[model samples]
Target: MRPGVSLRTKIYGLVITIAVIAFACSLWLSIDNTRTYLNEQMQSHAQDTATSLGLSISPYMDGNSPMVVETMVAAIFDSGYYLSMVLTDADGRELLTLENPVEIDGVPAWFIRYFPIQAPTQLTDINNGWQMTGQLAVTSNPGSSHDKLWRNARNNGYLSVFIGGVALALAHLILSSVLLPLHQLEQQAMAVTHKQFATITPLPSTRELNTVTQAMNSMVTNLQTSFTQMAMHAEKLSSDAFIDPLTKLGNRRAFENQFIAQVGEMQDNDLATLGLIQLPSLQVINAKLGYEAGNGYIRQASEVISQALAHRTSGTLYRTGGSCFFFKVASAGATVEELCNHLHEQFSALYSSHYSEGFANIIATSYDNKQQLNPLVSQLDNLLTRESSTTGTGLVYWAPEQESQLQHANGLHQWGEIIDDLLASNQVTFMFQPVLACEGNQTSENVLYFELFSQFLQDGIPLANSELYAMAELLNKSLELDKMLLQQLLTIGDFKRDVTVALNITHQTVHSAEFGEWLEEFYQHNASNLPTLVLEISETAILASIDSSIRFIQQVKACGIQVCIERFGSSFTSFKYLRGLDVDYLKIDGSYISDLDENPGNTHVIQAASQVGHGVGVKVLATHVENETSLRLLEELACDGVQGNFIQPTKKLAPYSEKKQCQYWPI
Candidate 1:
């Protein structure tokens, strides 16, 4: 295809060319007509002079008084109107002649040469009472005629130029107006290429362009609809795989899957709290009040538990069994006591209002990442069984453990002090986990980038981000902590080269205008020393403050940093949000990737996520890819990247200059 000129430019050029030609033709005609009229006037003046002079001098032409004739002709010639005048005797003897050289003033020589004016000479006979003498000839000077012609042509030329200029301006505006819609359509088309679909408004008035715009709009609408449906399907697959149909909570499978993932991924200092709520007489209720009533009671229990867990982060609720509902959360002692108290009140009310012989038993426990799931579940089961055998309605109970450990571990004030001390002393470090791109059967040692996990050191032990961020939020020091971590990351000189790092941010930081401003300024000064930076905002954080997240992403992207939607598929929201966010990567949450090959439904969910992410040009990455089976599954699903223990365990962040390839990468 050949390079094409814009319609607007072509039209403007044509209009200008035609205007110039028309202006030239019009000026030429006006000057030519004026020149002809002035020549006729000059001829008339010369003829009148000659006739008057010849009649007057005719009476004195009797072969004498030659001086009188000469004086009369010389007088007219001296008036500077005539170029020359002459008188002759009857026998054509010697005559007196008067003449002056022609010279025009106030006109260029080129103008006079280009537009020549003819100076007509008039002749009349001098008769002495019917005896004619020689002729009297008079010629007019062309200076005045040439000057008039030049003035008329110049004035006409100036007026034509002004009119042409106005015409060209109006043509330019009209062409721009006519082509404005086309420009919008071109932008729309380009946006589609980038997987962004949009419609143009205020369609062009031109019939042809309007039809074309309508067609374009239709095409965009169809594409948008297809993508929306694709995303919705992906979301539905994710929901179906993880969600329990009865309570709309995570099922046992999801809980166990995510439980293993969280334990492996969580820091040693992080605390995990678990609770089990059992409706002891659910079978009896089903036999007595019908299965519908049993289902209704189960739903009521789920709702009550959900209400108790409100406003809490990192909490997961699961319908582990027909009569067993469970929850695991990263929270402190005060939160666990609150949850138990709330459940106690709600269950007591349900028992008094709806049941006569039935009660709910609640048992809870707290531990660090070291505890295995089987022992914790066994302990909770034993406690609940003991409580169910003999208890008041809806009894709140806790498994026996070391009081000093729970107090020391779950104390909010202690965590606050520890966080303050950590920030004060700048005791912050990061663990960089390499994300490797998928290459089918080919194994490459190259890394896509490393995700930075912030760790706060307390007594030489690394504190989990969940714990640090929770304490920071309670102390209203989230922005300070985030800024410190970002500053620390930026100060690393080793990040100046081929290294790329993604830093996870909290919901508070995502919505903090001050943080945004500080980040922009900091990046401006230290951009050269920075690696390829990506701000990872969790899927839940984006949903929590969507507009703010969008603004923050755009703002940071303007500074040349990329963004990633981390923990994707953890939330059951529509994929439509991805349309509004200009993100570079989507990190599919680890739960879906854990034991991926064992669960067939998770395959479709991951496939759907991959489709949606790739549809919008976003790279799809799997987290917690722990085994060869899971890794192979992710590769088969066409995932763009994978990061987990199987790839490389999180290690202390070191300069890439010191270690080009981590130990995990095959040589």
Candidate 2:
């Protein structure tokens, strides 16, 4: 049979086994000791009783009756020590008999069976005179001994249970205390594996556990630092791979990625519009003014284009090539013609006045249908070639009829081939627009304000600024353009007087540490001769690189240069950023100022902006003031200055006193 076992049963069995073995040895020893002592007492009691009875019976045998012997025996039995007593004659026949009984208390039969103790009886023979006449016998009761044995056994069993329980409780408490730290360590390891990097502040109680925790913390800290560094390096590499180093604008690779994504989205959603603009005379301009001016034009154009597209809630602009650019727009069901007209008006007005003679030849092509981009691009090429044959005047949209001509023009890739030649020649030129002060207390202190502008030279003639910038962006030479423009401005020595000349700074240039270092060197060389220069930055550019822009501004300020925020209100909610930047001027966007008199909304906006600017200690300059009325309104609103067609056209740099002496319009 399988061994019978249960927790209680096993415990009982073990206890019983141990107890039985112990009790057997103990009982044997105790019983031997008890037997020896009890026997001696019993023998002594028997001898005493027998001797007394014999002495009394001897009198009876000599002269008394049998009753007298019986009385003596009864007296001895009544003493309670003997179980039985007998008196006999010389022939050993019973003469008198007596019996003794004893009662046991406080003991069970089981106790007695578990630990039975017995004492042997003793017998003695007595003789009258010389012969044995009778036998005397005495027996002792063991009730007291049995009761004592039972009580001792029960006490031992209880003691055994108490000792086992105490041992179990102590064992459990010790085990838990020893293993608790290991459990905590396991949890911390899991957290680190999941990138939590949580610290273990509570040290383990044991020295070995504390050592392990310290080692883990050190390893995790190192790994976390390394991982962060690796991630930053990877991000830098990825950005470099897809960005144009010069323009800091998205390059052809970036354009392609965006183009594919937009096209796929448009195809799936059927809600987007695509537009492309190609600057036809970029090469000619780059050739005339040098690559630096060419790059300046591109940077300027990119900023303007980006600003224009941003006005539309959901549109993105991309520099696709040296002379080509792309845009994606969510039309919100607006007609292509309406969009095109709006773009045409904005581009024409902005570029014509700044670029002079070169504005007339630039072209913009747009495609709105999701299924017609390829055909549209082809048609645009044809239109460009046809226009080139003629005067290259105004904008053109692709029509179905141009398909045949597009096929013919497909073989001509002249635009790309001329770029290198154009860059090799110094064909770019810089221009300036005067930002006239509108305040009534005007003094001829030669405090003339001007904004930087650029153009591309074509066939010894200038190309429009927009066209040049678009081309530079496409060629991935925006930084080069900016550098060239700055060089040309310095070469012209227009900033010799105590005037403020504002130059546009791109986010790409501002973010580049190398560019910053180069700028420091340039300023060091021109420190004594430099005018009170003001660097103008767009809100969009600032938002894109807030930290770098702030750092650049600080560096420029350290060089004694002023910083202004251009197109300030274009980013409607970006005014909050002004609190963090140290800016001297806020140039209000022309869009909000164009119809200020007619549009209460526009007037309210300008008024509110003026208050905000003055509140923050920044001077406000209103742009695109077209007539006497707008100028008067700007002055009424306490605008610090104004710049527009209505203001005096920018003249060649003259002595500081002479330029400030002439007032184009009397306020």
Candidate 3:
């Protein structure tokens, strides 16, 4: 209806219209030309045949014979060119007539009718004397011409349809190729916006598409780099906020968070063993050594302590203060004594060689199931005060004696006040007993030694070592107590002779980096001033953290310190562990040596232990040598050293200058 329309629709309509018009025009031109040519040919043939027939039939007409006329007409029709022929006289009556029709092959009747060819009819008048006589007619068949025209038109129509179909298919393929790259670019852009950083795939030949892909790839790379920088910045911030810059350990806040979490887990699992180790002499160490040395020691001690507790079942270590560290362990079903013994063994091995003098006073508290954390902590504080009074040489545990002392107290607050005062002021006393060489009745090497024993208040009031230790444990201040006692000894006691001072170590004290650093510095400064120190660890302590203890011992041994395992063979079987420990001495348990002569079994056990120690190149010292019989049996068993009431009596520190050698003291 409209002159101008959509190109696609117009193209379609125009193509159809042009094709139809072309077909119609071709049909008309072909049919007209064919029909005209055929009609002319037929007309010519009919005229020639009629003229010849008329000439031939002239003689017959002159003779007025019907047979002659019929013969002539038949001859013209038999020529195969004419369909009908007729001859007649001038009176308008027929003289002779011949009819013949042709059959065409492979032509439809409707096609023939649609494109029919008309042949011209010929007429002749026969005259006797130049007047009107008769008419002649001749017609020819044109079926072959009509059939040729129909076939030509069909062939041309099929050719037009084939060309049109091919053009349509090619157009669709070309359009698809042009739009495909655009679709791909769109998808890539969407992915980048969502932070996918996906790489763009190669696109087809469009110039604009290639440019877009290159731009997108560049943007993705830049964004990835930016993200990496941001992540690094965030990590730095997080470390600075939550970590201790000095020791690289978790700060108080972080430790508290972790502690609460670990406690919850321990409670949920129904674990029972909780112990604390306090460093009672860190302030003394720091004062003696520079702050740098102190910090180094703290760092080293923290590392060692962390390593010791590394294998602890559901436990974590915290750097609680400048010199304090704390840890908690769930015995995972072990008895209170068993857990304490285990801790003592493990920690003893760790610090036994490092700081022999400083480590001797490390105290630990173990609480039974019935004890709560608060009361146990109070008890440990009291024990520490009692031990600190004496020159700080012994490790205290929670025992019945401590509980009895607490029961006699006026009240919980009063006990706390008294304990606090004892802790603040050095209201404690220490008694040192010498460790003599076992070669002869005469002293071989003057190794001035002492075992720490605690006395509270003005040095006469006895405090239960076990109760004080338990109170420290409850307070989670074992490290603090250990450091305090060590500091007290270093500040108050005099060490000027060639002596091997032995001290106890707790698990927390052994693992402290601060302690480790202090030991290193102390050894360096006192290389010429102090005696060759020996550190004694309880066998029970060494077994709790064997690997950590081994490492700690090795480090301390490297610094020229001596290591010893005390109270050996007292707890569960630990002979196997003894073989692996690098120790200079093994002190036999007092229970095994108290009456060696009366008990052959005790003598046999002592003989076996002495043999084992000698085999490993370790010297065996017998403790609690009270009577002459016990001392004689120890000598017979090849004991290396002896310490007991029969050997010597405890003396005041000042009298050591006058009485250089100690004779056997009667009990």
Candidate 4:
């Protein structure tokens, strides 16, 4: 638990400690044996000299020849082994004595003191002719023993160091090789904590380590797969939460959700346009021709309204009432006069041809951004009352005084302030709704991915994705807005505890090179995130430039991002786009999803679209699913996923920054 210590260092220290202990024991034994050997040898040498001199002196004593004895003692003493020799007569008189000072050069005094070799002495008595002789004593020199002992220790010291050095080197090499795989596993595990998955290649020689490595690799792979599946399911569950079921348009809840999202970008100079199309006699027709016939007419009219508004800069068609359809238009350039013209002609045709006795009239008005919605709705209602009293068939009315006050998103300068404020503050959040799969478990807990709608917070109100994105497209700032949203999302790196994110890209970004480059850089910087980032584009834009979109989407995919086309099948040319473009998910247009089980026409197209999507390995998901019946029908048609109000509603969630990162490390 100590700081700044690693496993390798501990191993190294342990090995060196054991080596030091073993060598010290060996050195002590070596020095002890050498000292003992030298001491015995010295003793033996002294004894030999004393015995030799004693016998020679005995003969000298018997003859009473001291000179001879002295001469013999001197001869023996000259040898380096003997340090001193002494011989005497029988009466204890000294007959002969030889002494020599001994010094062993090149041996330090400290070495001798620390590694002392004691000199040995031996004694003998000389006796001749029954008379007692003097004793002869010899001393052996120990300097030679000390020198030998020093040489032996020096050699042993060098050998011990050499052996220890080589041992440490070999130990380090083997230890490093063994621990390398473990280190890689640790790195891989850390990356996974951040929701990134990477494979490791380790071929260990040891059986246990090799097994551990293989197990770690398999664990990482499984974690990655599970995370991907979770992300997809959560995305489906989230998308189904808000989308309306009947008209294939955002229901009242979805509209309010979008409206709240757009409120943030509302400025004093901004305009909010609301228009209603009323069919008063539709209820009468329903009573006479039956509810089935009435419902068919409403469905047909809803489709036409959505189609008409599809080509416009930005608008959402909503079924607000039993016999009414409305449009929510917010722009700075001009009113949706073109859309009204298309409406008048279509309604005029139905009326002039006498398609039915039901009369339809369109009324539109624009209000300054500061006005509240209640007053606007009231004003529109008063206008409809006038229509009910004065006109019967096809009629178009505009608020006489407010038409001139309309403004469109005409210039960058006009929107520069609002956009800049959003960018600077990053005052935006995404509302996520669950998109459930029809054929699978429909629990929100099991969903892994959620579809996101970006809302920018302005003046204490959040602007919905529709308005924020629509205006961005109108001002040609769609690419910039996309980049900004991406940056913001990256800041919220974690989602659903290791989930993949499906982000919707506006049309301008899908076609812009600038956005492409920005996306590439963003992915590269966030590669560690292994975000499982999925980019979604609408079929409306992809159909226009299938080839270019295919190329751009491929480029993004090459950067390790997933691509999908939202609102698929807007054109029957689904075959054309599906043929050339590579996509992962095809979100079937909501209209086809509404009452899919009941409408044979919608079912036929759904089946065909699902087949084509599956043929290309793309998943087909029906959005705006409202009832269990429609969900069951889509499942029967082989829908990969289903998202709508029937599954779950859109909900706000805790921001990613506040959540904990996933931890999947093995204990």
TM-score of 2: 0.39
Give the alpha-carbon lDDT of every model.
0.79, 0.59, 0.59, 0.67
lDDT of 3 at 489: 56
Per-model TM-score versus the true fold = 0.74, 0.39, 0.37, 0.45
User: Model 2, which residues run further than 4 Å from truth?
Assistant: 1-424, 440-448, 494-496, 650-667
Candidate 4 lDDT, tens digit per residue, 463-577? 4344455566756777777787778776665554455667788777787777778778878887775456778887767866766787788688778777778877543332533
Could you give candidate 2's per-residue lDDT for residues 1-667 as a string of tens digits? 2244534445546655765676566656655565456556766767777766665566457435777877777876786667777666666677777776666778876765655555435555555577555666666666655555555555655665565456545744654564566656666665554234555677777788789978887876765555445434433543454456555665665555444433432212133445666554456668887778767767766776677665443456667668676666543222333455666666566564335333322233433225545575566566756765656554444333322322112111333333344466656654456787755633122334777555556577544333233334434455665666566656566454466677887545666677667778888897666566788887767877777887877787767778888866543442445544667888986655655555434555566677666645678888777677777778878888888656755443444555564454111
**Predicted candidate 1 versus true structure: per-residue lDDT over 293-341, tens digit per residue:** 9999899888878877755656667897799998886654555666777
Error of 1 at 202 (Å): 6.9
Lowest lDDT sum, 10 consecutive residues, model 2, at 403-412
On lDDT, the leading prediction is 1
Q: Arrange candidates by TM-score, descending.
A: 1, 4, 2, 3
